[model samples]
Target: MVSCKNVFLTLTLVVIASNQCECGVYSLIRDLLQWNVAGIPIIHKTVKWDFDPEVSQKRREQFFELHGYRAGKYLERIGLGIDGKQRERAYQHAIRDQGKLQGLSILQP
Candidate 1:
């Protein structure tokens, strides 16, 4: 059985891989051409996908933990300040800035 984290990663990859161009074309066209037409090899003889249940389980657990750590680091790299606490500040600001316009419409002049 595929772990939930693995499934999520697969879905994310599929979303990225199945890109749509501005003219409504599948971006896979470029990828397919690159593999078939270009000099890129689809698979190398050295690489292999072997199945071992114990290794698979251990790797999946390690991947889940590592992904969480890496994701946190990446968010920190791009975040404005810190994490979690900012949500409360942002929420309060939104509530304060909603203004007293209970039902006023800007179009009505």
Candidate 2:
């Protein structure tokens, strides 16, 4: 029988991996693209522009610790600015990068 510790470790890894993204980055990209195509406002003043660097750094570290280098680069590439519409490209890149790091073969519909 497998040891409890081994099972716990496996479960922990699975949980950590699942925290990377929701519905995959490709899907997010597609959504953003569609939103743009539809002439919907992509950027707004309501969006938080000044997320603390310390918090972002902590989150980035957590992402790296959980997903490793490739994933970390994905987030780094996206950046944390409050430029709403202007930041789409970076956000998309980060999402794509994160997807790659997580071993997710998801495609945008």
TM-score on alpha carbons, each prediction: 0.20, 0.21
The runs of at least 3 residues in candidate 1 whose Cα sits more than 4 Å from the true structure, single-residue gaps closed, are 1-49, 69-109
- lDDT for 18 in candidate 1 is 67
lDDT of 1: 0.58
Q: After superposition, how far is residue 86 of candidate 2 from its true place, in Å?
A: 38
lDDT of 2 by residue, 48-88 (tens): 67656689888877978876776865565455454666477
| Per-residue lDDT of candidate 1, residues 1-109 (tens digit) | 8898896566456546766542334455555544664547645436768877799888767866765554764453344356657777657655864644534544556
Clashing pairs in 1: none
lDDT of 2 at 86: 41
Cα deviation of 63, candidate 1, in Å: 1.4
Q: Give the TM-score comparing model 1 with the true structure, all chains together.
A: 0.20
